[model samples]
Target: MPAEVDLKRYSKRFANLKSKKETPLTARIQIVGIGDDGLDGLTGQARQLIKNATVLVGPSLLLDKIGNTDSKRIVVGSNLQQLQQAIKELGDSSAVVLASGDPLFYGIARYLTETFGKDRFEVIPHVSSMQLAFARVKESWDDAYLTNLATQPLDRVVDNIRTAELVGLFTTESITPAVVAEALLDRRIDYFTGYVCENLGTPDETVTQGDLQSIRTQSFGSMNVMVLVRRHGAADRPSGSAQRRLFGNPDDLFLQSRPKRGLLTPSEVRCIALAELSLTPTSVVWDVGAGSGSLAIEAAAIANKGKVFAIEMDAEDFALMIENAKMFDVPSLVPIHGQAPEAWKELPDANAIFVGGSGRIVPELVSSAIKRLTSGGRIVVNVSSPDNLVAVQQVLGDAAMQPDVRMINIARGQYQLDRVRFASLNPTFLVLGQK
Candidate 1:
């Protein structure tokens, strides 16, 4: 049959179907993921679904690749609104929508499901190009950070790449592997081995591997996936101190002990706690329970000319704190390797103190530390539980110091497969009082 004859027959049937007054049965839309290999890449069940579909819908590129089909075809472009209207006009016709790779992973399936409803469509996924790219490079993607350039800003993606161990990116024509490589180098992030997999699952498939500097100088096919693997044991290179802020640096910049990485106070919470302390250039500060010395190091940076002592009971954490202080070049920061109170017994009274820990003895520690606080100095205690918050508040109340209490709830935005989602941090309670 001629292509025009098929279109006319399809149009007339669609018109007659739409003119009926009675509502038709719910449309069955099968969204099938295809690769560059076209029908050859599809499974038996997926190919059968396409053959049985009464109406076919997809972008021109994908529709062109499918060749001849008995189903009536609707060519969709970037205009999704038109696609939705066309699907609606089908009026209960079984339609098959073709997409590239795994439609759910940064593909069109999410848009279709969101536009219609979950019950209206069934999704059959093919191997995503990201997965193929990782496979080509012989790397695991389970823990890799994956995202699309179409949805996220390049600068934000570069920042995220700075701290990630592995990354898989869906590249657009305008934002190719070369463009991403340039952005990373501009930010002084040069520890990754880059791989650009092009035309995956096809006869013309090619995988290009190079360093960021080399990748930045080369061009690649529009259909490509960019994968970055951090070089083994490569530590993150810090930006020049002149460009760094006095406080609120990214948490990744600090070296943290494994298995207890969450022990460090989050950067957002650290900023708030530091503000509450209100230290001066010449003020003395103490960080009690300073796991990894995040708070004490930032404090030393703020009080550049002042002394900041970080007290930790864990030997490993204490060593990490010392290394972190050196990493940030904060000569004024001191690491005390002992339990608090006893650790600070020989040190001078501090103008500001930050206590961060949980347990029944936290309140007692706060009570004892306050006596060593200089007159007119502030003490800020950060606890994760309500019980500790109340206990610390009661201790301040007994010392005749009215404490200002705050509960901080923080949620950070992170890129998932296709979109950005918020991940909430554990809530923290901060109690600040003056001696």
Candidate 2:
């Protein structure tokens, strides 16, 4: 019994020693997130850390808010390299680096941690101004696209805002809320309700709510966070430029049902399908299973003098298709809200047909659709599964159409954490046949 007790004790001691060696010690350099309200906004622990800090580092504005601290101060400026050197000179001294809002959220902590490994510094975050802005407007930000105008360009930011359902931006002195609002209006993106929260967490805090047009003309304080919430059921407007392309518009430009977003034919696939159709200026085109009218609208733009029918079965998707067609301003595009074969009974014979969907009945739909294709006209079928690919090929073969098959594999490049990553779309197969 005594031997067993001794063995357990020894094992416990060894485990403790192993854990100590494995666990990294808390860093001496503390990066604390502070607000405009300064010391009063800090937690007790954060306040004590600042009070006991041997050296303090922050912007001149933030250092001014520290009042009379005995700790040595180093002011941060545009040159971050100098700040890094100052922090490095502190060596073994206990130092506190102050930042605005959450230190890790587009703040200096990322730079500091990258310069001198994460193990050398501990970060304590406060409520971000962006969070306060959303809270003031009573909106949830978990899914909001948050960015900083200080770090990213305004044009790129406005482009991203075009498709986002919700957006939060940290407005800089130069790129204030009014400036951002103006830029958005310049792009004709006026669907969102804008809110500018200024001097958050301070006595002089103000929250201004208005439309993008009103916000554009109004002046705001330098310190502000802008929040934009897209209006419900509002379709994104097409680009206001007259130089817009006739065909192959970007997939995002169309309004698709949220749950059925991926149902729309990708731009690359749509371009290939449209090309295969060999549409004439006055060709009658049918886009069967057109979820959001992406292909139908583009076809209408190409066949300006002709008619394009977008047939969709789902009621919600049909409504979305109508909205999308209007947004694209394709007057020649007509939406038919019913299943195939029956839907096209009253319609004219099509010069070109594009069949797109992943249903098991796609083979049957394609077979029926080809019957409506005029002699010497083209038909293109887009399918994702190999089974459907073979089935469609067989149907075309039975009609002696001699289908030409092509598989499309696309990978779009995405920028993440200063690196380019490729996100691949599911491979799609296009089977083209001419009557």
- Find the candidate with the highest lDDT and give its number: 1
Question: Which 10-residue window of candidate 1 scores lowest in summed lDDT?
Answer: 235-244
Per-residue lDDT over 1-435 for candidate 2, one digit per residue giving the tens place of the 0 to 100 score: 454467888999999987785654544799999998998999998999899998999898888887898999988875798988888788888899989989888889999988989889989998988888898999998888788777777877787787788999988889988899888888778889999998999999999999999999899989889999998866665455445567877776777665345677999998899999999889999999988788998999999999999898889888888877776789899999999879999999999999998989999999999898899999999999999999999999999899999999999885433346797999999999999
Clashing pairs in 1: none
Tens digits of lDDT, candidate 1, 1-435: 654567888999999998889955696789999999999999999999999998889998898787898999999887889888987887788889989999888878888888888888899999988889999999999899888898888877887787788999988999999999998898678889999999999999999999999999999999999999988756554442345568988777776665465678999999999999998888899999999888999999989899999899998788778777877889889889999778999999999999999878899999999999999999999999999998999999999899999899999988766466998989999999998
RMSD of each: 9.5, 6.4
lDDT of 1 at 5: 63
**Total clashes for model 2:** 0
Which residue runs does candidate 2 get wrong by more than 4 Å?
Answer: 1-27, 252-263, 278-284, 290-293, 300-339, 346-348, 358-364, 374-377, 383-411, 414-435
Every candidate's lDDT: 0.88, 0.87
